[model samples]
Target: MGRAPSDSAGGDRLRFLRSFLASPRKVGAVLPTSRRTVDNTLDLAPLEEARWVVELGAGTGVYTRGILERVGSDARVVAFEVDAQLSSILASQLRDPRLSVVSDSAVNVARHLDGAAVDVIVSAVPFTSLPVPERKQILRAARDALGREGIMLVLQYSPLIERELRQTFTYVRRRLSPLNVPPAFLFACQGDPRSPAGER
Candidate 1:
């Protein structure tokens, strides 16, 4: 018999805690993201019309599942998770052909894209915890990976990434999701004029 929904949820929490304990900086949060925060983050992304979507730091498949629900049947989602165990669990649980769980760092996102233009990029990455050079590298990769009309949606516990987003994208919009655990900031960014693909 299949596991009960509550059991599955419990397992996810346990796994998330273990991952966080193993790598506090990479996992960022002790608990998985709240559903409200996931909704707030996705609300700004153009997922319904997106052909290719990239999710950075897809912990426990919370936002990954949300992305699958919102995108069309033909859409593709590439979810990056730095933790090997989390990546493995997410891939096995979802088992959706539309989703690809990449066991790699977000900085290597561009390499996995195979040059396909991404329509929307959703990030749960803990930029504040990363080294400056690494953060900038990932941001640059994300910017260059997007198509002309692409948008990048970021959910962060702090607004520390706002300046970086503004510098990378010509248009950056911020919203607050206060109902989330610890409250969170959402950034919807587009219009990277410097992108080789042109303005977005």
Candidate 2:
């Protein structure tokens, strides 16, 4: 069988640019997540034994593939992409029984999770570019969706949201990847133990 309409590499990049132009804040970058960014982000998450992994803003499946590669065969990956076009392409390109590509706002991620506690969440969402309220909302949802021992890895071009992440997660650590387009900051967060698993 041939690759789907959204499966072409050149076409994917062109569509990514159009999506970025349509919603700069949401798309965040003109190009997809770089290898260095993805590597640094996933390194913070314990993906080897992760049974449930959630990927936010999985633009072109860069981090999605990284997570999948490191996770066990029984692992389940829930990828949230607000852009329908990009989400469609992801659904086409990543056809694994373990993956679920949801076309929805990242703030509403918990709604699609069915009360499952996530083991790791690799977020490529642009926290710096989004409005403060949306940023808080999405972070809150992610916090609630995590298990007590869950880990969240957020990748951004700036450290603007480090304080915000600290507010949600009990233990927050930051790392920098200098090889990306504009370089990037990765925040590794461990959820507060007081919250119940999958409460959101």
Candidate with best lDDT: 1
Candidate 1 lDDT over residue span 1-200, tens digit each: 12112217788999999999998987888888888898899999778899999999998988887888888888889999989989998888888778899999999998899999999999999998988998899998998898888999998899988998998898999999999888999999998867565456
- Using alpha carbons, what is the TM-score of model 2? 0.90
How displaced is residue 60 in candidate 1, in Å? 0.2
Model 1, position 14: C-alpha lDDT score: 96
For residues 111-157, write the lDDT of model 2, one tens digit per residue. Answer: 89889999998898998898999999999899888887888889988
lDDT assessment of candidate 2: 0.85
Worst 10 residues of 1 by lDDT: 1-10
TM-score of each: 0.93, 0.90
- Of the candidates shown, which would achieve the greatest TM-score relative to the real structure? 1
Clashing pairs in 2: none
For model 2, the stretches where C-alpha displacement exceeds 4 angstroms are: 1-9, 193-200
